[model samples]
Target: MMVKQYLNDLVSLFFPQTCAGCDVPLAYGEQLICTACWFHLPYTYAHLDSENASARQFWGRVKLEAAASYLYFKEASRVQQIIYHFKYKSRPELGLILGERYGELLKESPPFNRADVIVPVPLHPAKLRKRGYNQSALFAEGLCRAMQIPVAALCLARVKATRSQTQVNRYARHENMLEAFEIRDPEIIGGKHVLLADDVLTTGATIEACASVLLDAGAAKVSAVTIAKAL
Candidate 1:
């Protein structure tokens, strides 16, 4: 036990834990984030507006009740660092932390407060196996805990993995994601309001695909929430 404690102390000394966003020294018991940076994180509060910019991204293509993101992701902003840690570093708790923290504000927003279920954009099985966990699902779990809503993990399933949407143009977004997702259970989501969760909204291709599947399965309404908006 003493040897283990010494090893832990050595690791802490070498790593010298700092906030992922601001590089500030973390206090005792703090994880990869710090309290100061956490409070200063930018929030859009777009869900409260009927025609927020994030929701307007899907204007003619898809229908949604409301949508919002917790942060605005700029190229080199702290939000990018947070997302980087959550996405590529295997620190999924960052996603949940942001979701749970954002959930408080979301619960007070109109329409969002009434969502019956939370559905996370599904990752293909191969990708999920490689990543060990899905960031969107982790975010949804946190939102579910904060809102007291149930999380529908497999409501949407990816039929197959596709090439990255980044290299594709605007016109190819929909086609690139064609038949990528399908509803696993229609009965549960039929006629129910759903709050779709994802890590980021970049061109809205993946969300659109997932939303299409859910709507086809008879979901009464579909709204979206994400950690950041990449616009």
Candidate 2:
């Protein structure tokens, strides 16, 4: 262990590790994100309350037990850069690290603490193949580590590919997401409280669709958490 640490330190000396959020050199004890950036990032304290804005967003749309996001996402901000890298730059570990940290916080919150399983919003097979990984599932894996809950990645699946939700209005987003997801094995989630996870929450059309399918497949209840929420 001592030898490995020494070699890692030597490597870092030659190629300094940089913070994912700010691109600054990380101090010795810091991991992916530096302490300053971590503290200054816009955290949404929504997990502490069941009636937060995130949960309210799903009020009339879906039967959600709870919902919350860890951070507030803004365009061209540090959170956005981190998420951009997490999804597009093959930095899946960033999702895991953020999810684990957020999961620890969620474990202290209500309905979220009662989750029996973690299920990530699935990517279409083609997209998954192209990306070489499911960013949401990586986040779920880290959440499971901290919450000590099981993850059911294959229980739900994206049945169809949809166009980018970014270029569309709310109605178009909802229409595009229709029938995009399906439950592959209802038995795994039946009678269980599922916590659906994703990288970000935007117009929330995708999450609403996933939660609807989970409920229809016999899930007792559905909650949701994301790394960030778009304003």
Candidate 3:
């Protein structure tokens, strides 16, 4: 045990884990994010209000149980930096850590707590192969750990690999995502309240499409959650 501890200490000395939110070396007890950075995150707490912006964005497009996010993502902000590390920098654990923390908070929020299953938005097979893992699926695993909810990672799939939505107009974004997702293993989603998860909420086209598939598959209700909400 002593030798193992020494080896672990040596590794830490040479390769310290930094806080995802602040890029600072984490204190001994800190995991992914430091306490200070955690306290400062732009939390939306949208779960507290059913009509929060995250939900409102889907108002006319799809029926939902709840739609919310953990943080506000702004360009060059701490939340963005944290997400950047996971989405583009290949730090998939960032998604899991963020989802676990968010799931802890969602325990007190309705519809979210009542969700029988968590379904992460899927990536195209090509993208999944390139990225090595689905960041959303990692987030789903974390939420499953904290919320004691099962995750149906394969219930929904992205059929078409479309262009990036960053440069697309709102109408075009919806069009681009149309028919992009299909329901698989509908038995898992049928008659269950599902909490659909993703990394970010921007135009929300992705979430809308996923929810539509869930509802059509007989999901009693569907709520949307994300690590960040891009405003």
Candidate 4:
């Protein structure tokens, strides 16, 4: 064991892990994010407020039981940079880390504590094959780790491959996602309050699209949470 620890330490000394938020070399016992950077992250505390901006996004459009985000994302900010890494840089573990941390907080919040299961937004089969992993599913896995709840990973399906959301306005994004999602297994969501998981809350069109189908499938209610929110 001592020899193994020595070899691992030698390897880490040459290629150290760094914090995702600030790109600083992490210290012992630190994970993806360093303690200081984690403490300084722009947390939204959306879990504490029902009428928060993220929840308010679906006010007149969708009947979400609740919606919340963990961090505030702004262009060129640390949150945005980290999120870019999370989605595009093959750092899917970041999703799990953030989700687990958020789940710890969600356990204390009324709206989310009632959520019986977590259902991550799905990726179309082609995209899932290309990406090799779904960021939202990884996030849900992490949340399940911390929340001690089940993740119904195959409960929903993204049937249509819509245009890149970044290329469209909010209305167009919603239209693009309409009928794009379907419940793969209604029994998984039936009569259960679902906590919908995603990497970020942008225009919220995708969440709106996914939540509608889950509710129609007999989910008691749907609540949404994400790693960050674009304001």
Q: Model 2 — which ten-residue stretch has the worst lDDT?
A: 170-179
User: Per-residue lDDT for 1-231 in model 1, tens only?
Assistant: 999989977888787887889877787678878888777777787867878888888888888888888888889878998899888988888878888887888888878889999999989999899999999999999898788889989878888788877887866868778678888888879999999999999888888878877888899999999999996
Query: Which stretches of model 3 miss by more than 4 angstroms?
Result: 166-172
Model 4, position 196, has a per-residue lDDT of 97
Ten contiguous residues with the weakest lDDT in model 1 = 170-179
* Candidate whose lDDT is highest: 2
**Which structure is stronger by TM-score: 1 or 3?**
3
Instruction: Give TM-scores for every candidate, taking all chains together and pairing residue i with residue i.
Output: 0.90, 0.94, 0.94, 0.94
| Model 4 ranges off by over 4 Å | 164-173
| lDDT per residue as tens, model 2, 25-118 | 9998998899999999999999987788899999888999999999999998999989998999889899899989998998888889899999
Q: What is candidate 2's CA lDDT for residue 122?
A: 98
Task: Name the lDDT of candidate 4.
Answer: 0.90
User: CA shift at 24, candidate 1, in angstroms?
Assistant: 2.9
Cα lDDT, all candidates: 0.86, 0.92, 0.90, 0.90
lDDT of 4 by residue, 25-95 (tens): 99998988889878878999988999999999999988999999999998877888788888888899999
Candidate 2 clashing pairs, residues 3+ apart or interchain: none
Model 3, span 1-231: residue lDDT tens: 999999988888899989877889988878888899988999998989988999899988999988999999999889988988898888988888888899898987788999999999999999999989999999999999899999999989999998888897888877788778989799998899999999999878899888988998899999999988998
List the RMSD of every prediction in angstroms: 2.5, 1.7, 1.6, 1.7
